[model samples]
Target: MLGDMILRAFRLTVRVSAVVQSSCQCPALHSCRALHSSPVLWAGHNKWSKVKDIKIPKDAARARMIAKYTMMIRIAVREGGANPEFNVALAQLLEQCRNKNLPKATIEGAIKGAKSKQGAQYLYEASGPGGCMLLIEVLTDNNTRSHQEIKRIMVKHGGALCEGARRNFDRKGVVAASRDGISSEKALELAIEAGAEDVQETEDEEEKPILQFICDITSMKAVRSALESLGVHTLSAGLEFVSHTPSLLNHAQLETASTLLEALNDCPDVVRVWDNIHAQNSQGN
Candidate 1:
């Protein structure tokens, strides 16, 4: 009887050990399968996801740039005439569009749209973060809709539409040029000769060097012509509202202000957005 009981006990221990071993093996198999199957799939998925994320913003920015140029073309032709030869503004705008790789057909379509009274120009002003001001230019067929949309965006982005915000800015001609091949001294001399009020050198988001020439609003054409005659390529030459007293913001305030500006700029009707927020490191009130 004692021998039989001991044998039964040994059998029960074996059964329990087998059950535990099987449970452990099941998890090991599952883990092996997961590890082997997921690395390649996850890596590929992650790579594609990153590409998609980058491409989306780039494509959207390109679209916005095209749309802004299109609107400017339409406004130029409408205010003047479709004949580029007779309309200097339209001619300049056409050249600008071409520089941006805007399609010929798109330019022509914008001109045609202008003739049909498809849209009107509007200027909006709002107070943004850190006591900075914004000047938003828009072209839209519906004034009420544009106003409501712009107001909503401003309010949502920690800004509010304010009256007479333009008073804080000076309307002037701004000419932006790349400093790729031009020396600072040469740029300053040229700007002074062109009757520019100020010549400032700055870097773009990519840290590319840029030179800006500020002049009286009425002197843009002359300044632009002077630069072109000297074989200096201008990136952009147009009227802009520059802040007289720029507001300095901290990093957090700058982020919020930048977000608001980008949101305003992404609107289809918004052509350009100007702000009085000083550079990140600048000291201002």
Candidate 2:
């Protein structure tokens, strides 16, 4: 039902995001969040949003992939250094981008841009349809331009910039892992052993099952290490704004929320968008 309705948008907001914050109190960091209907409320997309992962053209997908990786690479360079050999994080990112088959020129260009001291990360908050809260993660060199653009996008899409949306969410650490051949019991066991508070199963665009482990933000790295030691293949480890209460949207609201997310993500500067929107269970109505 959702696939037919959600637009095919390009790259969007996620710092693994849409992770996370580095505690930069300076004019960076945007906020908004949730009330708690589910432990694992967001992971790339939630239950209702996942089915809407319809395919776009192969070229388009690759372009979007490249765009996302480009920003990620730039961020890594800005955080660490341009020299991947010295920056373990940058080296790992380069490997991941290579695995995605990002063009050599694109990778090189991102690295080159990082040396200019540009790339700053920010999050912007907005209220969407059904009053769903959204957090848009952005990576840009031009803060003023990006800010104005995001505000414009929000206004154009039935959304508006609003403060205090962050109250709805708890900033928690999230570790994504492979769910292949792993049962729920096994997932729980791993979560317990790794000191993760909870584990919820979701999927990628390809429908491959994924496990999202929730942990205290400070223990994020430790939890990931623990899981790896327990023989789990860790996909990515980062912080996320997990909602305490997910907003339940009616049909029209659901449709509008989907489009709003897509629109926010469409911005080239946007890294990823986090939200508290979930479809109202028809069974309950």
Candidate 3:
């Protein structure tokens, strides 16, 4: 989507901005003006703000996902077996951990603890602004702590937790993949043939056009099986939100929002941050 392209452009511009700000010892005023006046720099900053206003909730969401996965791994071992070959969820989590390059010892320890039956399970939730929705995957022995943290983050970020957010999320599972050399139509066909509910494009300046497919939760396994049956190379595959309306931001506000989102994202508990921050054309917010 154009939003993804905007994000990539924003990131690149930010890197360039950082270089400019760092190398210019000539005058502080001159360097600041360059940052504010540069077209690319301004566009990037604006895009970032839109993302922050809508996409990112706070750090707590990530922290929650990590905790939930940890608990799930523990539960998987205690109930089925430590060896992933016999435990599907454990195997999937293991695959995810491996894909993310998580420490071997960490994965092993989670399994071992699960085998000991010393782990507790936690539920995940989503929250958002008035019309925004957030999906939060969390893990915690103390539900109160998790809930409070999530609530705090939402309030701090001009959003809140509510039962309503659940309505915005499609329980149907979705997977994201990329087709660098292929056209968007081709990617859509592959996904549809695999029984995908919907297919959307991804925007990446340097990479191939990315596509995402939505399928029934039960059909997700089938979709993956079919994709594998076709031998397609997917850049990423996971569940994500489909925002109703993407948000927008001004240039100055965008910069501030980007910082807020990054700060919140840096929190360990946060797992995934999604929002509709880019849905307009403008020079400022």
The residue-by-residue lDDT of candidate 1 on 1-285, one tens digit each, is 999999999999999999889878788877876899988999999998987998777777777778888888888887888998988778877877765677888888888888776778988988998888888899988999999999999889899999888988998888887787788899889998878888878764334688889999888878878887877778777676777888878888889998998889878889888887876565442
- By lDDT rank, best first, the candidates go 1, 2, 3
lDDT of 2: 0.78
> Which ten contiguous residues of candidate 2 have the minimum total lDDT?
7-16
TM-score of each model, paired residue for residue: 0.75, 0.67, 0.56
Ranking by TM-score: 1, 2, 3
Stronger candidate by lDDT (2 vs 3):
2
- Candidate 3 off by > 4 Å: 1-72, 75-81, 115-130, 176-183, 201-210, 229-231, 235-265, 270-285
lDDT (C-alpha) at residue 269 in model 3: 48
> TM-score of model 3 relative to the true fold?
0.56
Model 2, 162-186: lDDT tens per residue? 9988888889988888887999999
Judge candidate 2 at residue 107 and give its lDDT: 91
lDDT of 3 at 2: 100
